[model samples]
Target: MVRNPLRAFFMMLGIAIGIASLTAMSTIGESTRQETMRQFKNMVGNYDLINIEPGASATRGMPSLTTVEPTLKFGDSDAIVEQVSGVKQVADVQNAFDLNVKYRDRTTAAAVYGITANWLEMHSYFIDFGSVLTDEDVASVARVAVIGPDIQNDLFEREDPIGKQIRIGGVPFLVKGVLVTRGAGPGGSSLDGIVFIPVTTASKRLFNRDYLTTITVELIEPLNPEPVLQEITAVLRERHGIIPPGEDDFGFVNPRAAAEQVAEVDSALTRILTGISVIATIIGGTVIMSLMLIAVSERRREIGVRRAMGATREDIMHQFLIEAAAASLVGGVVGTLLGVGGGVIAVLQQSMPPLIVWKSIGLAVVLSIIVGLIFGLQPAWKAANTDPIEALRS
Candidate 1:
């Protein structure tokens, strides 16, 4: 390497780029997968939670926007709590979107949901300050409201939002609490840009509807939700007077089903990244092999000198192979550092949580070594087979 610095550097560069690209891809992919799982956990609260909504849509990504009369209702929530054997909690939601929300001099359009008091607990949300809605707030059709962190920042600035009145849909609502920051939910939608009001108040005053948009159920044992799901389906079917042969008007977002969907997407992404990494490493190895063959030709006289001094063919082969392997091994080390830096930059650009998968770095090193051995063999063999008498003449 010292004798031919430029050649060694160029050979190392090829491997460096290949390993770096592979490591960066794997790191970014792992981070994205973790972030996706976390977002789903936030939306669903627990693995045992089931989100049920009325609609005929084939997709479970979002609840169907069905009419109030034929869809889920507040009554379904009561029935689910009473009839389901292993039920733990039922949270009913009635939401109206893109509403004109106002507080003194600030105004913004946001989503609003009328929710039962236990909705916060079921969804794993906590108040940063003040208090969450109580049963009394839902029962008396109180005009109290809880706002998310984004709403807090936009409306109140440094002023305290607690005890302050905000108007939703032209009706006065007292701000009871401010929710902690929740960055995004499904589909990258903002979660902190919503407001929560009492379910009764939402039905009677704001939207003037007695139907529910969704019912989120938390069960006692989450390991197997089959029996609970069946019970829920049976109860709703009976209440709606639907026959078994006909398609039901409602759909369910089962935790296991949603998890499978997430895993599928993650798997597809991993395959694409892994394919790219393999291609890069192969190209890098090919470059190294080509360079080594050229080096062998230039150093033929050196090999002859060693052979003339009693160096065996095996010795020549081992020297060249070891040199090639060393280049790739060093490159792998440098690439690991570069890859981590690249991944951090990418994640920072998107404001995602930072995480490093050390396994990817180890894999890069191991794979690079393998590439060195595979591609270096042919050049080493050719160097070893050279005749000492012919080489000295050259």
Candidate 2:
């Protein structure tokens, strides 16, 4: 192997390309799955949390915040809390998009949400500083606001936002708290560019409507949302006076169902890519076999001389096999390192979390060695069977 530098490199190069592709694909697949779940959790909460939006079209996706729907009401939220058995907490929500938010001379557009006090907790949000909204704020219709990190930066900059008054749609509001940064949402929208106010204040003082945009429900027994879902559907249908065959006025977003959909898509893509990598590895093995056969032909004289010198057939075969395995092993190690670096860069480009699957790397190295032994068998046999008398005469 040391004497034939060019031949050894070609053998190593083929295996390296295949192993690199396999390892990198495995890393990317795992990272994508994890990142998708995390992003979903941030936007949709857990399986235990269900969001009910106005209009049947919401079943496909979240309803537009700008779409004016009068079908869902605040009473529906109260009824769910009182009537639904497995219900833990219910928060009524109303939202307005692209509202002009101003603090002194600074201004920016943001999504303003009118929410119950428990909205933050239900959505897994925490206050970075100051305080969250209280029941009193909603009841008394207090003109107070909680700002997101992006909102704080765009309007306040170096100034402290807490206790400072900011204007939303030209109405003055006291900044009660700032939320911990949530970064970008699942749909690539900015989650941090938002403002929260009491639902009552938004209805009476700002939008002046008697409706809600959505009702988010947290369940006690999350593993089975069917019973709770049925009950909620029944309550809403009966309250809205919808009979059989009538399309319901509300839609449900089940976090678990959404998660399953995402997993299916990711799984399909991963399988296709993995199959391609396997084919490449097989091609690499084929290349190794072809090259080794050529090497055996070129070195026929060496094999003949060794046989004349009383070197056993088994010894000649073993020597060739070991050379093949050594080349593959070195290539595997190099490929694994390169694959990990490539995977990290790919995930980072997609703004995904970096994750390494050590199990896959170990398996890839083992497989490379196995491929070397299997492909080298034919060449080893031919070298071992070379005749000595004819070669000496030549």
Candidate 3:
């Protein structure tokens, strides 16, 4: 019986497939979790600026002042920062609408932002070359531009881009800086494809619009965000002469809260995927059990001969159990190797992080052994109970 490599090979194959399936699922799930964390970190770092929108209840009291607009202005940002306590810095940004930027003969749809000097500090932006916009540049309305890495590579190539002029909406602005590669954000939006310019320059040269698209604010140290949010909301309400809270037109977001929400979503996804993988493992265990029972029936004569030759019931049980365990062990090893390889491939191709979880591997190995013991018990017991005289006669 021990010399039958062919039988053992087929048994091991089934267990191996089951283990591999489970391992692959776990690896992918872990990779997803890592990717989610990376994206959440990029979206909102340690803190967030709040955007306040009017609630529905406020609309009933004052129809004129309670009507909420869809947008907020740069002027509103300034008022909130100045009047609200616990507010440190304000970076008011305005977006250009459908602006066609031309670089000689090359042109593309570009997202242009008009940002304050503190935008670099607030966002922790590092320039690859030249310099970011200065306070003087903003005050003087300097027509300078900071291009993203994609724009630099596409339009500039190896040529020196600093001091080169690019036309946006037919207005020529000199290239002042090139931004370092920041890759893509969690929203799958390109972070390295836009252009940044001083808010004052954008206001004077382009849209001439007084309204701001968004404002990101930094809070003072040791201040709880909830109270700070309330203070900012009150200031904005007072400044806008908002008689009704429901009609307020602004919106606020806390980056910390957003990160927490993302974490919760990722946790739920991990649990769901993990549960499915576990079910696959269980199915594999069932297959192993069924196969073992068939093998016991076929090998009854061999078991009877062994018993007739002085093998005890305990010996027969141990032998059969060992064969089942050997199959599971082989499967566990092969599955772990395949899982690790698949994880590496996923990380390389999908921009997801490598998740090498030792605990998951350990759990998989332990589960495989447990599955062997549990599934093999009935077959091993049947082999042990074989009557030497009856099995021999059959």
Candidate 4:
């Protein structure tokens, strides 16, 4: 390193870049994965839950067009809850978006959902105060509303919301329930800026559409979702008059399964990137090996003097190998620090939570060192085999 700083710097630069790319890719992938998983759990999703929406496309990440006629309905939720085996609970949800909500002189735009009486159980949510929707409320299409905690802060302003009259979409609704505080749901949005009403009331008063936007199903204990999936598919197909060869116009969104699949794909991509990094490391090693070979050729006199002082062939090989490994090792450390630091900053600047992965760091350093050893061997061998007398003559 003292005699050939420039060559060592070039060699280290290559290895450092390789390590940095590898680490940065892994870190970014994992940070996104973690955020996705957190959002999945925060929303109306869990391993036992299944979401039924209108779509038949097999593609991922592409938005599917909704049919002119809706497919999933409130009756589907009833059938799933009553007839389907291995089913625990079911909720039918119909959404009215960006509607005006009013209480006394205060008015704000909020989303209103017409959900079943079992909406709380479906979302694992509890009532902070007041009462949840009842079967009677659904049957009679009662104008009762359950406000999330944020609505409480906004409209109620610490006053008791229960028994208060609020206008949702210009329809009068009594504040029957108040939901507990839920900070953030999927996509990093607060759950509080929403109102919940009975599906019948929503159908009669709000959207006036008989079809549901979503059907949420929660399965019984220890049951695999596959059987339930088949059962529900069969039911939906029969109801919708679809034959075996035809596909249903509804799609299933299983968050847990999707999250797992996402993780699998991310792992595969990371492996590919890691392989590319390894190749880069090997190229760096090749450069170092070539430089060492040139150094041996140019320092023939020095080698001869060392040989005269009783330095063995093995000693010469060890010295050259150590120098190559040291360069790569230093590169590895610098790259790890830079890569991790960059990832943290990028995630934070984007308003995402940062996650540090120690395994990637360790892997980068270890791979770099291994690359140095494997590629350094040939040069070390040639230097070791050099004849002292021939080198002195040259």
Candidate that scores best on TM-score? 1
Give lDDT tens digits, candidate 1, residues 328-380: 88887888789888987897787787678888889999988888878888989
For candidate 3, lDDT tens digit of each residue in 250-369?
A: 556656666567677777876776677667666766766777888888877888899989999999999878878777777777877886787678766876777777888888888878
Q: Write the per-residue lDDT of candidate 4 for residues 1-394, one digit (tens) a residue.
A: 7787898788788778878777877677678768766765766435667778887642222234555347787677777767789888888889877899999999887889998888777777788988898888988999999998878777889799999999997899999889887667657888778899998899988888978888878878524677788898888887878897787788777766666776677677767876786677677778878887887788787777778799999998898788778888888788888888888888788678988888888888898888778777887788888899987788
Clashing pairs in 1: none
RMSD of each: 2.4, 2.8, 4.8, 3.1
Q: Lowest lDDT 10-mer window, candidate 1? A: 57-66
Is candidate 2 or 3 superior in TM-score? 2
TM-score, cand. 4: 0.86
Which of the two candidates, 1 or 2, achieves a greater TM-score against the reference? 1
Task: Estimate the overall C-alpha local distance difference test score of candidate 1.
Answer: 0.85
Model 4 C-alpha RMSD to native: 3.1
Model 4 residue 269 lDDT score? 76
Give the winner by lDDT: 2
Instruction: Give Cα distance to truth, residue 100, candidate 3, Å.
Output: 1.9
